[model samples]
Target: METFVCAGCGRIYLENSQRCGHCGGDLEERPASGRGIVYSFSSVHMGARGMPTPYLLALVELEEGGRILARLADNDEGEPSIGDKVVFSGLSDTGPVFRLF
Candidate 1:
């Protein structure tokens, strides 16, 4: 039910607003098909940022369009590949972490 509008182009976005800063043309409410590739990733070793240490952070490129940065779920034991098919998980109560399916 949350909403945001781009300051630059006046685009309205629903839950997901990372891509469409303005002009909703490229915006999507959810990751298309829940499938995406791991565009990049990083490991957090410090808890200074308020997140648990040793967590994986990544930018996932959705199959349809747009990219989102999220935390890799604890259940994901295998390393993510660039073109791996990832399924969409529900919004996180803690942070933006998605489960790999």
Candidate 2:
């Protein structure tokens, strides 16, 4: 199962689990309303712990109000920019990630 961190309160959640463990904040499977903007990003080239090289990581701001740091989808092209619109897809087995639409 996948897991996620609460943007509202920094609580961790299992995929099958609902709500924030620490704050009881409502947890949606995807970014609320399928809308968000890229807040920041980075390209990893080395020493990525358990991950492969050349991965794109980003912090995204949800339209409903919150920020989540996630990996960008593999199919994405070009560098993601601040304020670039994004949509939530499924979680990566290694981490949570969002795809650019």
Candidate 3:
């Protein structure tokens, strides 16, 4: 994946930007590690069409310092836990998803 990085301040954003939101400087696109730790998560019993109910939604703190709000896939490792290492698992129609590493 790619992230927007501020050329002036080095701030990273998960989304593309014409300019840096923090410094109003030029933004550049860079490859993202797509690796992070599960910061927090919640189970949603209700969701949009075709979305699996009772799926996990989480905040992943990327190794690059950028955080992404994404759906999480369960692993044989048991329930999701705070600070669990995860890796990008591609995307569903809804959004990007991650799996426990």
Among these predicted structures, which one has the highest TM-score?
3
Model 3 Cα shift for residue 3 (angstroms): 2.5
Tens digits of per-residue lDDT, candidate 1, 1-101, equal 23344545544443664667444445434324566677887777885666668877888776655567777776646676666566556567555565667
Question: In candidate 1, which residue pairs clash?
Answer: 6-21, 11-23
- Top candidate on lDDT is 3
TM-score per candidate, in order? 0.62, 0.69, 0.71
Measure candidate 1: CA RMSD.
Answer: 5.1
For residue 16, give model 2's deviation from the true position in Å: 5.2
**Which candidate model has the greater TM-score, 2 or 3?**
3
lDDT order of candidates, top first: 3, 2, 1
Mark the regions of model 2 whose C-alpha exceeds 4 Å error after superposition.
1-31
Superposed by TM-score, candidate 3 places the C-alpha of residue 91 at a distance from the truth, in angstroms, of 2.4
Model 2 Cα lDDT, one tens digit per residue, 19-47: 68777776655424646789998888984
C-alpha displacement of 79 in model 3, angstroms?
A: 1.0
Candidate 2 TM-score to native: 0.69
On lDDT, who's better, 1 or 3? 3
